[model samples]
Target: MDPFHTYTALSHQELGDRLFQGELIIFSIADELAPFLNRTKQLINKHFGIPDPQKAHLALDEPTYAARASETMTAFERDPEIKSLFFSALETCGVNREENFYDRLVLRIVPCVTSYDKGRQASVKHHRDTWGSNIDSQINWWLPIFPLRKARSIALYPDYWNKKVANTTSDWSFSRYLAEKKATPSGEKIAYPSSPQALESIDEQACFTPELQPGEILTFASAHLHGSKFNLTDKFRFSVEIRTVNIHDVKHGKGAPNVDNAGNVPMYQWFKQIKDDKKLVL
Candidate 1:
């Protein structure tokens, strides 16, 4: 079977099974998310006082960029219209949002700028989600807020699914990272202090599907070795990433293999309990 499957090709059960088995899936519901994406762009422009969303990339260098971005993301997530639209989009894509508890979805608005600064790289380095979070059963949903053309998208190294890579996971602790992240104020010189130094040594045999259209969602397990490809384009990359986990899988240890340390705390404070109609207090 192909490593990548489309939404129409799999049922909800199949998608769940495939994800646990370490496969990635891509599907499009761009039409459903168009309004929300537009609203997000508008919100960014309004918050930053930029006339053009494309030109908004220049504001990333501002001292208040992280705080401003976090505020904008909170507003976007709290907007009733956007929340409803996003939930509907998840349902349309075969995800039972109620059944699977999720962490706060993040709005990633990456500019074309790259920083050579150590410990505070603008672009992500090759790493697995397990390195930062304890949820071995976590599954990530990623979608582009705008169309991606040419070689501009995240790549997954499928060849390393079961292969080991030399990383800093042994010396890195998620709890320490989280504490440091929280203690540091927005716009400060915060860094992922223990980022793997051997990332460049990893082979480049990755699956880079750069033709992802707007509204297409990429779903993959947290254990997948993935990272951003160099954004050669001048346009900013707007995207959203939400992580979900099946309680059953986590309880039974049925998800992807975990080799990294568990987080000191779960990434979320509460989960939307789907089965009993009651909130799952974590």
Candidate 2:
């Protein structure tokens, strides 16, 4: 995508509306730019020393665990075009940077093989990106490095902000679990929130799972619940995820921490009971 051209193409009002109503929006640069995107991916792989792209998997086994790559701020600083695209995605999103936008960006590449194996379920469980975060001004941008075919997709609750379950409880634990959908069925092996009550409040009609192609971007609020589905395709799945936080919103800001490490909590453990038993289907 021509960073400048696309940024100008997307109307500011359209961008604002996207952020206001839906928790997420998917976009892509023109396909004609595929060769450029591919070269960037190749460079990233060379810098990281990952195996050939053709051999990557999507399963979550020991091999999958070994497949991890990240680029620091310096990487962006090194390339002007990369920086333009990075900033353009934000500008196109109508981010109010002048209001002291303290957005942080991250780039992540997940090899396809990580999801290829039987035990490679990437259902990391639903959770808000804002939980325990002092700064509530954050959003996620997921851009797949390659095209996603059938079975490789992302699922999201379309109008999650409209759900009665949102902020229903002042109790941090109950509220967070409900918001994250990490709560399991009550009295079951898993300590999920009472499914009958929770499900009753959610709009079953608003759920959606959209498959993303290379260069496509999915942006959403930190409170939105989202996750990756098991890879059903033989091709490798790679993507660059960027997160932005409004710095002025920080109040004794703890800063964003690792999502994988949040499992130590009791509520997280309760959800895991369902996960361990493979009973969490919702």
Q: All candidates' lDDT scores? A: 0.66, 0.44
State every prediction's TM-score relative to the real structure: 0.81, 0.53
Q: What are the per-residue Cα lDDT tens digits for candidate 2 across 13-115?
A: 4543444444356565545335546556766566545465535432233443333332322363356566445554555445444422322333433334543
RMSD of each: 3.8, 12.3
The segments of candidate 2 whose C-alpha lies over 4 angstroms from its true place after superposition are 1-14, 31-39, 47-54, 57-84, 92-104, 110-123, 132-137, 164-207, 245-282
Candidate 1 residue-wise lDDT at 118: 17
For model 2, give the 10-residue run with minimal summed lDDT: 271-280
In angstroms, give how far residue 125 of model 2 lies from its true place. Answer: 2.3
Off by over 4 Å in 1: 1-3, 57-61, 64-71, 115-121, 193-200, 259-282
Q: Give the per-residue lDDT digits (tens) of candidate 1, residues 1-282.
A: 356777644555677689867888887677777777777667767776655554454545544555565677677767766666666677777667556777656676665555422122255668887666656777888888777864667778887778777777656755576788788765455565534333347677555554677778889988888877767777756677777776666666667776544334544443554333355454
